[model samples]
Target: MRRYLLCTVLFFTMISCVVNRTVVAKPILFDAEREQLTLEYMRDRYGLETSSSAIDPKMIVLHWTVIPTMEESYKAFYEAKLPNWRPDLENVSGLNVSSQFLIDQDGTIYQLLPETTMARHVIGLNHCAIGVENVGGGEGLPLTRKQLKSNVWLVKYLKEKYDIDYVIGHYEYTNFEGHELWLEKDSAYRTVKTDPGEHFMKKVRKATRKLEFKLVPEK
Candidate 1:
């Protein structure tokens, strides 16, 4: 009887370890100030009107900043408010641009926000998607292999934590079409956006497929 009890305890201990390892912990970059302000911006700028229980994420969207460095991109996204450069951006402030994660050209992953909070990266889908921004997409700083690998790791991590159904590129967000989650207040808000292009998203999807995530349909 003692030997049987010992075996049962060992089995449970192994199961606990597996659960712990698979669970995605909140990324370290989550700033309380930024999180609170982001939620407020979502309410005021996008008119999302979310309650504490409303922010259940269902997809992960990938993007590129077009900026040269990760630090610059981080600074741009870290501000509590929006910027004026994108004055044409109808959503209150350009500061509404944010993602939960940022992957650098060299392949370093920077967690800019937590997975549970809403980031203003994608219009219509911000309430149900987690955005991941990749640094550098211009001629001088192209996306690299390292960034691709890091994206795979990050996608897998998020899938393990949330009930994530789709892993999509920013450009493909429109493909959701009639899905209930594709909602935004302004019709003009659905402007054309192509970032972290098709090639990059294809790589991310192929890598993440090994982990069993469904790829967002190509538009």
Candidate 2:
């Protein structure tokens, strides 16, 4: 009985270590009305069924918030209901853009929205891509190594949970514009993106190469 107890204790210690390695903050759920807007956007923009707000996500697009501080970034997202002064996006959803996840410079991860739910982070590919936004990438506030490591952890977690097909930086999303993945209604509504730089993408792809994501065909 003592030997069996020892084995059980060791087993639980390993499980505890595994969970500690990939620490994530509890999600702050959005109100029903905001989620409803996401559902309506998916249907109206992509002509998808409204049975659920969860998207049939196939890709993961990484981003960086140009906003300098974490506090300001959270406030911006928390306060805004509709996108301000963006006339083109108003027709798409009129909703201020958000991501499924956001990471702080110190490597803390937070779920801003449900994993499968669509948030308007990327154009043309929002219907099929999940966005992961990092809290810094501005001139004064660059991304950190901690953020990169945490991203790898989070991406691995997501891969195990979903059939994730492609992982790309926000800039690379345009490469899929002509592919079947592109589903935006207004052709001219596209915006250029450079968030989550090439170096960051290279690091993530290298760490996650075993996941076997599909290539974004050349334009």
Candidate 3:
């Protein structure tokens, strides 16, 4: 009986270690210029003129890089200015696109920036959304099962750390357009997204349904 109890305790301990694994730090450029650009974006796009770039997160947004590798995705978000390749976003602000956390294909999580700092990921909800971007989701580079497990762990971790109320995919951001959480000033500036596809989100939502996160608002 003693041996059986010890074995059960060990098994649960191992499981806890895997679920609460440490996130690897792979920070992007977040100099004074980037901070200024972030503030400018908040003021211009969301009509939120604040002195600091800090945000009180209320939602978590999951995304797929569409870029093949972690290194390439990191480079894309390295600088403060929008790259020439992303002309569609340049009109909005010079601040380059980024997220607070980035997950590699192997389930390794990276913290690109501070958790509460605002990142320009989801439209209309940047003011209060924390973004988690997975390394691949384009062509042959589909997101791996390891990445899904990592995302679930990450969502639970963030929910525990913050007062998070909702978890939504990048593709579902538009559904909150007129909801109280929506704050974009330019209605015409919306862009259609199909990232971290429906199947992926359904699995994540199902796994995290016990958290009691609010449902996505109807469009």
lDDT of each: 0.73, 0.80, 0.92
Candidate 2 residue-wise lDDT, 16-113, digit = tens: 85478754554443677777777777776677767677778888999999887777666656633664645666765756778888888988888777
Write the residue-wise lDDT of candidate 3 on 1-219 in tens digits: 999999999999979977779899888999999999999999998888799999999999999999988999999988988999999888889999999999999999999999999998998999999999999895678889999999999999999999999999999999998899889999898888988989899999998999999999988
- Candidate 1: which stretches are off by over 4 Å? 1-48, 90-95, 215-219
User: Which candidate has the top score in lDDT?
Assistant: 3
Worst ten in a row by lDDT for model 1: 21-30
Per-residue lDDT for 64 in model 3? 98
- Deviating ranges (above 4 Å) for candidate 2: 1-19, 26-29, 83-88
Which lDDT value does model 1 have at 122? 83
Between the candidate structures 1 and 2, which one is better when assessed by TM-score?
A: 2
Ranking by lDDT: 3, 2, 1
| Candidate 2 structure, TM-score to reference | 0.84
Query: How many clashes show up in model 1?
Result: 1
**In model 1, what lDDT does residue 140 have?**
70
Candidate with best TM-score: 3
